[model samples]
Target: MNDWLLAPTLQGRTLRLESLSEVHAARLLRHLDEETTRYLSRGAPADLSVESVAGYLRALNAVPNRVNWAVVTNDGDVAGRISYSEVRPADRWVEIGTMLTTPFRGTTVNPEAKLLLLERAFEVLGANRVHFKVDSRNERSLRAMAKLGAVREGTLRRYQVRPDGFARDSVMFSILAEEWPAVREGLRERVDAALR
Candidate 1:
């Protein structure tokens, strides 16, 4: 949809969610490390070049229903990336995906990013449901999602194959429109507390 193609820049006290573009490739790649991507289906490339990442970002521009954002900290550093994918407008369902560099892991970047996206999904876009699928082995990520109040649905066994050949399970979590208010307030409180 056009909304995915032109996702307006979202701002928060701690970060800015800007459309992922070629120019952000270098900044995003600068902080990426093997440990940070260990949970992904394809591990960090042995050679993670700016050109490659840039090409990927550019290519994503044409993907119809996915919108990717560069998670930029207030000081103008690209801290990570987040996106809304698997968008099904007719069904009012969407999925959120994210990867944050270690430097910003413990900060408000994650929560604030969620607040913005969830707000847009439920409030602005009239989504009936928003979900996230995370590698089950990623305890930190699982905990983070649970902490945000997304109800755990179940695990998809052998959902993805890691680069090293491990069949990874994926944990599904979701928040329905009816559940949005509480989740939004929790995220707002977490993010707002940090802003103070």
Candidate 2:
């Protein structure tokens, strides 16, 4: 998929994913707490200065193959960021990752956002698969992925080295195009229940 074309806003009932921009840096900074950054390979930024955040935003925009979005509430508050990366058009697959703000966690925000992103990946982008890789030590993430109907593929030992210089194993999970119908229905149900 063309990078420009793939950047369209994906909207849901309570949230929207808009193309990531420098303007979002400030709002994003407020949410990247120690808890949020603990599992991120890059870890937390040593400095949360405006300039640093802007630089990070610029770097995100420069990536050619991936599209990052600022996850914002319907009322326009930025809640976090998510992206489709490791995009392989020929293979018709992509990997999704990133962190959400604490307030949005365990809420409908994540399920609905994933619903929107997965729909765009399978329906709009014609992806055959969408995958996620979480640090193997992260039980919460592992459970969350399972709840979403993603099949646990296996673990990759020493798959990534964190900024702290520690090698981390990654737990892989995926949902194939053929499984999208069932996965989508389940996610919709979860979102509905969450809203209620």
Most accurate candidate by TM-score: 2
Question: lDDT tens digits, residues 1-196, model 2?
Answer: 4742377888899999999989998888877677776797555556777678778767766777778899999888888888885688888898888678787899888888899989988988888999999999888889999999999999999998987899999999999999999999999999899788
Q: How close to the true structure is residue 72 of candidate 1, measured as C-alpha lDDT?
A: 92
Off by over 4 Å in 1: 1-5, 42-46, 59-64, 162-166
Global lDDT of each candidate: 0.85, 0.84
State the weakest 10-residue window (summed lDDT) of model 2.
1-10
lDDT of 1 by residue, 48-135 (tens): 7998778766766666778888999989899988888668888888899888998888789999999999998988888899999999
Stretches of candidate 2 off by over 4 Å are 3-5
